[model samples]
Target: MLGAALVAKKASELGLQVKPWVKTSLAPGSGVVTKYLLKSGLQKYFDQQGDLDETVASAIAENDIVAAAVLSGNRNFEGRVHPLTRANYLASPPLVVAYALAGTVDIDFDKEPIGTGKDGKSVVQSSVLPDMFKSTYESITKGNPTWNELSVPDSKLYSWDPNSTYIHDPPYFKGMTMDPPGAKRVKDAYCLLNFGDSITTDHISPAGSIHKDSPAANTFLSVGWIRKDFNSYGSRRGNDEVMARGTFANIRIVNKLLNGEVGPKTVHIPTGEKLYVFDAATRYKADGHDTIVLAGAEYGSGSSRDWAAKGPMLLGVKAVIAKSFERIHRSNLVGMGIVPLCFKAGEDADTLGLTGHERYTIDLPSSISEIKPGQDVTVTTDNGKSFTCTVRFDTEVELEYFNHGGILHYVIRNLSKQ
Candidate 1:
């Protein structure tokens, strides 16, 4: 993944000092990326930028700096990138080099120069894509389709172990409805999560190893799945029991509902008790209080993780009110029938004094047919205050899908009619 490690390297080469506060990390999707990074001479630059050296607390003796992670991979969501790093940017190898030199993304590449040339004139050099052997890439994929030609099991009715940890038949569709256009207002939803900018899909759909003490782990533990077989959330995705519990289970998320407490936590307002995020969600569902997420700019700003939306949907989150949203995340939310709302400029939960204790009511059109792009929706807070927001649905297709409570549900209804 295009990550902090690479950007740090670029910064080092240009004599730019990455602010020690900027949390940096290198989380490539695979080791092959590392091989090419070394082959392309980019790894040395990463090493130069931020050494696996001093801690932020240690670097505090020097300067209070913000950590910025640059990665080639696409997963740059909030807590998923790393707990310490607040800003994560996805960039090409060349842009990483430029940002490393510039030490920020707040630059006008067209108007501002990155660095000076040795000759004393403006150095306008852009990095070229490194060359790779076509044959090398071709050889790797040569036998992929040939392998798929292997025979399938004879029986159409596949056998299920029922107790398999890696796979399970999800019960989501067991009692599923195939209705159309059930759009409804988000009424009195609780703010399950409140955070600053750049919340990624990784933070939403955590793929890392399941924690032994997490709600997901507890379910497996209760089910007799030993800690050793408790495989990752990614591995247990087929099981709704695991995935539903695993939702919001990211250990790195610093949910404000927990008063700066780290890892899956929230405050169940009715009970005035703090609990793990999943447990809190269960309580809220039992209490019949719908949930909402309040966030700063770029909510859902990392990888296009679908579970980020699905997890919250399962948790009964009816809406997400954010200053802004990463495009793909906004779409994914709608694809799951979750209302994505944007705060009016200069407004957020903090500015309104919403301490995640306030009840929320969202006003929208009664049906998808009446809604239009960039439509205004009213949000009323508990203090008898109200503000208007723009609906985040950017397309008719998204609106239609959302009305039916998600793309799959919409497809099911349409197909049933056909």
Candidate 2:
């Protein structure tokens, strides 16, 4: 209303009218915004400029629970609005208004009469909103919006399916810790993946088609899946095991461990064997070993993927050393109880002469809770070489999250306190 009123006010002051070529609609975040306009008599300003409310109208009996809702805002795709609804529809504001006016999907809007007026053309008490809608907005004072009168969804929480494969309860909620675990170290950790610059979360955990010869594919095959039934990894992300196997499995990713191999290949330095990334990590775990990841500049630089960090944590990766990090992935790494480290100024993998075979030991302060952003850390190699690097923790809270074995445990601990 404000925008339209401004344009209308300018046109009227200049003794001109708005061109019909322009079109406009009001779709505020809250319905109470309409009440503000109406109470302030701003509704008339819009009307004077030929701007109708064009509000979507619908009738509902008592105790109606919305099974699904499609809005005019950006982001409308299959299973985008609600997972359980099974179907969703996207429409423009004007189309929403028309649908609400029609009120019934069974009646074709093009062929059926919407309704008859009171004078044989309509009996719009049900359609025009007899009292509740008008007075609700009118009850507020003009130009003085109040939160007490804002319309909100009656329900308290979003209903979720516990059995859903796409989105289920995140494991972080299972075991939470308010008082996180104490300070820890990255002990005898081998490098899980070694990559060049610009490794995105997608490269870390791809949701696209699982490759035929990929570890994920082999896992599926082991479970009796045919070649035709091997779906995308993204669809199975809710399951940690599948996603963990899919991590670092992007076909486009080139692991430096394989000396220019363009896939999830990695060398098991202890066993002196070449294997898939997931297989190597599993073998390392069975042998009671932890792992770390190594990357060049701008590591994890795309698409704030939670799984980029989550997958590595699940794969027994205890730390990540990179030249730099994209903001969210770094936080994600910390949130998952994995250490994020950065090389000292003017030092990186090549400069440090990291050959992807050296054993790594990350030293920590006595008190993990006191670890702050940009704190110094000592990364010592198996050959008795040590170098100082900056720990990438942004706050004591993040370190606390790490100590709690990721933020989920921290959240659970806090909730238990309440």
lDDT of 1: 0.71
Question: How displaced is residue 104 in candidate 1, in Å?
Answer: 24
**Candidate 2 lDDT over residue span 208-278, tens digit each:** 56667888778778878796776667678777767888888765577888899665678998887888888
Q: What is the lDDT of residue 140 in candidate 1?
A: 72
> Which candidate leads in TM-score?
1
lDDT of 1 by residue, 1-418 (tens): 2333344444465777644444344455544566566664556656633332346534532453445666666566543344344467887755665665565678887898654423211111111123333434556765667687966788887665687766777544556776664688778887787876766677778576677688888887887778778767777777766787877777567677788876677788778787887898888889888888888888887667888888888888989989999998899899888999898899887887777788889988776688887899888977787888888889888888877878888887888888
Number of clashing pairs per prediction, in order: 24, 9
RMSD of 2: 15.8
Indicate the residue-level lDDT of 224 in model 2: 80
What lDDT score is found at residue 234 in candidate 1?
Answer: 76
- Give me candidate 2's TM-score against the actual structure: 0.60
TM-score of each model, in listed order: 0.66, 0.60
* lDDT at 399, model 1: 81
